[model samples]
Target: MHRVLLWIKQDLRLDDHPALQAALDADRLLPVYVFDPELLQPGPLGCRRLGVHRARLLLESLAALDGELRQRGSALLVLQGSAERLIPSLAERLDMDEVLTLDEVAPEERAQLDAVRQRLGDIRLLLAPGNFLLRDDELPCPVDQLPTAFGPFRQLVEQRLPVFQPRPAPARLPALPDNAGAYFASLPSLSQLGLGEPLSVANSAFPFSGGEPAAQARLRDYLWLSQGVRQHQQTRNGMIGSEYSSKLSPWLASGCLSPRRVLAELRRHEAQYGRNDSTQALWQELLWRDFFRWTLLRHGGALFRAGGLKATARAPRQLDRRFQRWCQGRTGVPLVDANMRELAITGFMSNRGRQVVASYLVGELQQDWRHGAAWFEEHLLDYDPASNWGNWAYLAGIASDPRQRRLFNVLRQARQYDPDAAYVSLWLPELHGVPQHLRHTPFLLPHLQLDALGYPRLESIPENWRPYLPSAA
Candidate 1:
């Protein structure tokens, strides 16, 4: 009997899991999850590589995966250490026939795989696809031929591409070898992982916990139960409420859910209810997610570089208190401040809000773009390395797109998007009493009036802007 070790990474779910299925093909399967200390350690920016919101979500996912494995007569073995060393040592000690896991593309993640391979002594390493909607070989064109500009990429994908039908979960996994449960410790809690309990942000857009079961259930609730997908495109940009979007990104980011599974469900929805623009729009966003993933393949580690893929270097600005205020949501700009506050508290932000905040950070503040990207990496629940950094690169005008740098007019955006101050007030309650008319720019009022409203003054005000104020001196 060939005994193999299944080393799971971001691809966390069991259903539609090609890697997990391959492990079952062997005579014996030992599933293990190692909590790497390097990832949990604080980075130079003083934020853990994984923040509390995402850390808690990952723990939930592991628990759910383990529960499902137990029902199948197998269990996930949880260990804590450097995976590069621990995995090789485990494979050697157990005399495993092979190690099966998901393939990684990012430089840091790929490094771990390389280290394991060097230590495995010719052990077979079967790496499957990451959690992408379409695998590399399945692409309509060679990945290198895939366009960097989203328009061309989307055109090519929609014109000629196939989304693989997801495979069903196994009815029953083969039992582990005798005494496999004793091999490692149980899954760690939020506290055990050196993190505290999750911060309960009031009115968080994504209040759902993590795991495959939750991921599956959310798909049902959003589409079938509530018919939310029918209006997803319309309300997706709204910042105030949870009903606006599908909110499946957190699951998608962690690999608790597969993009193929989502695609299959969207197809079924169209078949049952007939086709519509809303359904098509949702499908397009998934393709955008695919576009970012492909960008990583095209550019490699350049995605992490300060200048992104553009060969030309950008001039730097002072990244001192101003940058820190932007991160902390203390920026004097009302819309920018509210969005930043939302992200800092909730680990989530709307698509529209993301664009506005990104524009404010890089275009208006003139700060280094990578710093904002890193802060999002530290805080966002649905943070995808490619999407987060890729979007930043695009916003900074250094990405593959031929477009020039774009800047959002924040005050105008606040009026158009939050005309009644509904979204703003929800996240920034201190400004709730600042009247609907003055909500967008509370500082425009006289100093006495601003103080009377109990709202804190913005960190800075533009000199020219004060001349037009209602009671400016």
Candidate 2:
């Protein structure tokens, strides 16, 4: 009998899963997920890699995966420890012929895979392509030779769009060995992981649960039911409500949803409704996601460095009370504070809000961008290493295109995106009594009124903000 130990990583779903498909060939298959305790500990940036929000989603995803596996005559074995040591030891004890898993691009994850490989000595360790939209062979050029900038890369890929044919979930997974029950362990709760349960926010943008079922349901709702994606380009920058965007990132990041699967459904939607700017916008986003992953593969640990791909770039490196204030949503800048507070409470923030706040931290506050990135790593339910670090570096002016530092004018962005200040009022209850016109510029309010509202006073206003401030303020 060909006994195979299937190790699950980021790709939690069985649908369109490459590693799970390869493992199906085994006569006796034991699928497992190794929950690394290190993720609960603080990293170099002094933030735990896995925070409450992500930990809760991860546990839910694991439970969902186990349910799906059990239906196919197998079950997921979640073990708490280092993958390198646990995987090898388990494989040797089980006398598995081989250990199989999906490959990864991030440096730390790659290192873990190597360590596991070394420990597996005589046993074969097979690696399948990771959970990404495009395969290496399908890339327009070698990853090393890919374009340095997103635009050029998008243009190059658009010239020859590869066809995506995602695999269906297997109807039957092989049964586990008779002794597998001894190794099975229960899933850990958020408290067990040393994280308090996050309070539910009625205004959460991503209110959906994590798993393949939820991911597929969302795809159907956005494309067929509500047809909200038809207006994606117009409403993508919206900061309020779940209808504003697809809200698929959390599942996408957790690998509960396959990028290829998303693309396939998107293509079908376009065929029936006819292509439009909105559909094209989502296509572009998937490409951007692919671009960042390729960039991470090419640059390795450099992507996470102080200078990113551009080592000589003059990136800010400072942290103080300003950083702490920014994190707690008390930056005294209404727009920045609202977005930060939303993220802290709901574990979700709009794309426009992210850029505006990140710009405020780097450009206005002049703090170290990595700290902000690390903070996102901890709180964001949709945090992906490549996209999170890459975008932060780009906005901080340390990534490939240093010339494109996303030093946005926060006041201008506030006026344009939150013109009515509804987003601001929703997140900042203290600003509710302020007039709509002056809500975003509370610093201009009289000393007594500002103090009464309990809002922090802006120490200094930028010259660019003068034009955007309300006349009444």
Candidate 3:
């Protein structure tokens, strides 16, 4: 090929970029990132589809990407418009022989790709795999035949599939065509994008900035330097601090770090410092991530349905006003409130916290699971379409091991995971300086004391649970 256009998406980094490598198979390359406003539009029932936190992270990642490309005598063209029109039009204007990009699995993503392809008519467009640890074509069987259970999928992939070595970034790139720089649209600022300046949450667990250097640095600290990976299984459930977990999800979701590279590095870490159950547990998470990718591929639009894989199943509970309390973290559940408030303020949350709140929404509040999923899609910093929606469906008992225990005992979870009440206190300031056990059930406090404590009592308590109040204890 003589010339090509590299359509960068979630895989924003230069290193280990398969699409970029294939584009460089030609003599000239033009890299472009389009800010499709469609992504930011409201989703079902007026739920926000994209939140400011994810948007800010994307901007930072892109700025870093463009800087790296510039150092290599190339640049990332920033455009704000419909990608379906922009990509095909730009390819024709630049006279590129081919357009290259990652093949997305989700329907919305595929729709965009299809639109661009339809517009390209007769132009060569190539799709490559950049995000998953094992690409779709590399799977042992086709997507349709993928195992329904995560355990089966993980076992089969681990035993049979090979995670190929990631392609290294090209040392140099052919510069843009003459005067092609003139086509560069000015990059939008945070304010222009409707996001406020990034600020520190009072006590966030994931505080890292966006970009490749940050991602690599974090990986090194978490796995190699600090050996956090060794203790991952033991501490990943903790809800308070950054070091409790790897904190790599934000970077992984944004594609600053390649999934294949993460898996490869894990293997290298095990090689250097003998393998253990903890490292295996970490590897299992990577498999789960890949499994969700396959889930999206196999099910396509079905995953978005209320019943998910079980389309014939009964409709999920509606998002009632009581569910509104769950969304605001004020459903008289200390643990749920803390986690929800943390997510609202910091744009992050612990995995254990996620499972707990998700279960609460579905099992206790009887809210439709899709509404909660949409909220996560809007607010989570590390939100990936497959993982966010798939997990939500799983928790709501709509997919992925629905027979498993569906409801979370939020009080039990609070005492078990955060006995000190330290995590709760940080997010729910009304309970700050309160006793550890007292924070868990403030509603049980006497009305006068509840007022003194500055916490609101939940009026919608179930009748049978009244005697189990804090005062009785």
RMSD of each: 2.7, 1.5, 2.3
| Cα-based TM-score, every candidate | 0.93, 0.97, 0.95
Q: How many clashing pairs in candidate 3?
A: 0
- Counted clashes in each candidate structure: 0, 0, 0
lDDT score at residue 315, model 3, on the 0-100 scale: 40
- Please provide, for model 3 over 1-473, each residue's C-alpha lDDT reduced to its tens digit, 9 standing for 90 to 100: 38888999888898788888777757788898988776777876466776888888888899898888988889999899899999999989888888899889889999989999999987888998758888766788887898988988877786776846777677788888775778876678878876666677758887778888899899888789999999988888988888888888999998999888888889889989989988888888888888888888878988888875673145465767877788788877888899998898889999999999987787767778888888898889999989988887766663224456446667778778987788888888888756667888887677888888666677766554444445546
Candidate that would win on TM-score:
2
Residue pairs in clash, model 3 = none
Candidate 1 at 165: error in angstroms? 1.5
lDDT digits (tens) for residues 278-321 of candidate 2? 99999999888888888888889987888755632677788999
lDDT of each: 0.81, 0.89, 0.82
Question: Candidate 1 on 1-473: residue-level lDDT in tens?
Answer: 88899998887789899888887777778888888767777687656678888888888899999999989888888888889888888888777889999987677788888889888887877898887888877787888888768898888777866746799889888768664656867677888767778777658888887899999999999879999999887887788877888888999999988889898999998999977888998998898898898887678788877765663246243477778988877775778888888887878999999999987887677787778888899889999988988888877764223355446777767777887878777766777777677777887667888777666677566554443343423
Ranking by lDDT: 2, 3, 1
- Evaluated at residue 145, the lDDT of candidate 3 is 90
